[model samples]
Target: MSIFKDFLLKFRESFKGTKPVIHSVLGNVFSMRVIGNKTHGDLAEIALTEYINEFVEDYSAVHTGKEKFRAKKFEEDISVTNKLTGATFPISIKTYGVGPLQLSTNKDGSMFSHLTEIVSKSEITNSQKIKDILKNPCFFNFSKVNVLPLIYDEKNKTFKIILFDLEKAYNSVSKVTYFPPRKYGKDRETFPIYKFFTADEQYIFEVRYGGAGANALQRGMWTHTENASPFFNEILNGTYQINEPLIKLVSKILVSPREKHEKILDLLRQLNGNS
Candidate 1:
């Protein structure tokens, strides 16, 4: 059996902690329908985290939060803990099904890319959860982290990512996040009145930090994502708009040439063995 399949098949047996719903994207196709509804997202998540814990020096996998957060702990889509520096941050993945919308504001001359969120409520309210972590001394192990953003295109099968220093970005650009909280029954119209993420400045972001060869926002090792349009800060007075599109980006991950899957499987095994 392929290493990926071996790990996945052993997922329930090896890791019996959290349950992140699996999803995937193989080249152009968003998600490949195998069983009823299962993809490599969750499986990859666990395998990657385990690999991080095992092989990736200076970093550990932190997918869950404090106990009080309750159902909110699992809000994190991807988090990396710097074992050496004792820092950690999360990468928030946002999907746009109908591609991305370019909104030009009439009030102010500004062009913003708008997208709908196809994730859980906790995904948006992560700031509150982060706030909780920031307050807890236990999380001091992860003293620093960048709240990175990844934009996945559903129709076009592409991704536009923004890697910003959450602290600096917040202080510099004007930001506006409105994904509702996890407090049950919060409809689409429900706005996150509490703490959220947006920009406060318009400075140029030094996109100097280039690709991780692999982006773990698959967010860790053995992962090289495709169809991505990564951007750093550009001169901007207007903000990027976000709205619910008819089609959301919630596709699955599927690779072609079959061997690609085997390659990932091999990488996973190598990492697992190292860990």
Candidate 2:
């Protein structure tokens, strides 16, 4: 190659090295708390899928969390494809604050019913019950279930991203203890909750049995991000840290008058050869 071509290539490589660690940041500039939980979650699902397509190497993503795809019992929000290997997998995206994170819901209450029977059976010991419960396919319906948690640390005012396999989580538990609703306390466990812990007593996660009726939706496996980060870290290497997203400008633009945005829209159309 020519000396000029070699120098140009080196310059491009050096510039690439200086790129920021976080390619895309997801979160609201204002309080994400102001937005309804479900709305923010849907937005986060789309944002993360786009981020993967744009930034993650050799990967393409498609959003699949719409009502049309509700047939998916696994609750997968997006499907990601490995371009090189031609492998694709579904991921359930969860958006939550730095607190007790709901991992998965008791969809159709099958898991709840199964666990209730297991817990009440007098023939099996508690240890054996837990072992049997974990062995159940209801907890793990598939060979691989991927979960991507986008945690917003309200205290630190930052966001964290982690993609982990749910099967690893099931295997990490060493013990399970049940906590029933308290009779006296103002702030008590409203329902019976089964807490899972690792061998060293690290809180892994919990399964809340929130009644058998309308509250069945609330009955889900929960985990504190800080407590469960270690398990997640081991699964997908680690988490990615991102600062608060620059959403003020985007929000302003969205809420601005149509007349004010007309010029910009025209320019965009012209750039796209639509004008």
Candidate 3:
């Protein structure tokens, strides 16, 4: 009997004999089906798909086209700019959800070390050109890097940015990689199944599972954005033009709901008719 077959046999016997044997055959079977054959590529595709779906659902629920705001990361705020009167008000969008795993391997350290070596050489030689090259975003590259800066728009006098954190994100899924069994013995091709010990000897199987690695967090964030970009562009840019007049109306309605309700309603009706 093969090692796997023997393992199954033992598991089957355990379930047959006693009621309190803590039968895990079903659990083991289910685990194997889901994670047993997964590859790194498979997990990545799944993660990316889920990240996009969740982002779109969450974003639409919170942002209604009625508000005119620009998102900015540098100052950590979304600013509503009044186009008509040229006034600006700061606003913020907060997202709560599951975040990705944060892990790093030796490979990441090696790349960083190499870049540091180059930077050190450039500094010692007093090469301003080399230093400038090193300072460029493309030159100082990594597998995962986050550049979140407050962008200034002097033309419009507005800043907009979004901050999102996923809720219960990790528990979304589990995965494992697959590996074939190894062969040994003189007649490995025809080795008897019973050669695998059953009675006294115990066997163990260890499988590495989960997309747990460095850059997982950044990858997850990228996945979410890639999924959401289409919808955001469509709704914000394509469907509705967020202008100064809209921002002022939204701000007024927020402060004076009773007085502005009818006027706001009228404006929306007209806007809809134009559309």
Candidate 4:
């Protein structure tokens, strides 16, 4: 190759690669900076799914008074059994973070929406027990509910865990209903979830819609990992207001929704005129 070409090739190689900017934002003014995962912390709802048990166990020694503790974790919550009472009641936890609340009530993946779709067309919806449960459909039936609050602060680089009882936190929900664009892809409208609390609860989170989150409906539940990192503000010593969520999907109430849905979905195998 020519000397000039060789020089050009070597120079191009040096500029060919650069570390990827994992996150970026620009508005009002002109400025640019490269950022890493360190900037955008893991949103709390995400932290709950990813590290609920770990953080809970991390703080359990400091918080609860129960004994012979055995635990189990599912999507967004945990159950600590007071072995003395044989109760594996679920307690909720979350890392303080940003983004939308995303406990979908009637969305596709949601247990109730999925079941509602199934039962509406099936015969088992006729079962007395099932009928009684669906008659109200209030709060959309969920399991082992209690709320425990937690804060994962980016500044301190630590998780400040707080415990809460959903049983006492003003058990109420908005029951929002709306249809999504074709992109969301469901014949029915969606219902995002929200669990509220009285002043006594440790934390509260809210999404001020107008940005991307508004475009995609969210607020309330452990939605995704992308939103886990949150800004933490301390009030009353680890007592901040969190938009608390009640663990509505009680296994005792729904009789194992996963199993129930699975069995019922087996229409060829589970259906008959009267059996």
Model number with the top TM-score:
2
Q: After superposition, how far is residue 122 of candidate 2 from its true place, in Å?
A: 9.1
The candidates, ranked best first by lDDT, are: 2, 1, 4, 3
Per-residue lDDT over 1-275 for candidate 2, one digit per residue giving the tens place of the 0 to 100 score: 43222322332242233443232335341144554446667777777676666556666789996784578767688887777767676777777777677777756666656666765422223566667787787776633445667676656756665544455666767776666665667764466667777778888787777455436336877778777776664211122332334445456788889997897779867885664
Clashing pairs in 2: none
Candidate scoring better on TM-score of 2 and 3? 2
Weakest 10 consecutive residues, lDDT, candidate 4?
A: 23-32
Comparing 2 and 3 on lDDT, the stronger one: 2
Q: What tens digits encode model 3's per-residue C-alpha lDDT throughout 1-275?
A: 32222322332343343342122211221122223333222222232223222322211111212123223312112223333344433322221111211211122233233334443222222345334433444323321222111111223433222221211111121211123224667645221110111122221111111122334222111212322222111111001122345345445667886757877668866975632
At residue 106, candidate 3 shows an lDDT of 23
Count of steric clashes across candidates, in order? 22, 0, 17, 31
**What does candidate 4's lDDT look like per residue over 29-131, in tens digits?**
0010012232222233333333323322222111221231222223223334332334343444333332332332222233334334443323331245333
**Model 4 CA RMSD to the hidden true structure, in angstroms:** 24.8
Worst 10 residues of 1 by lDDT: 104-113
lDDT of each: 0.31, 0.61, 0.27, 0.29
The local distance difference test score of model 3 is: 0.27
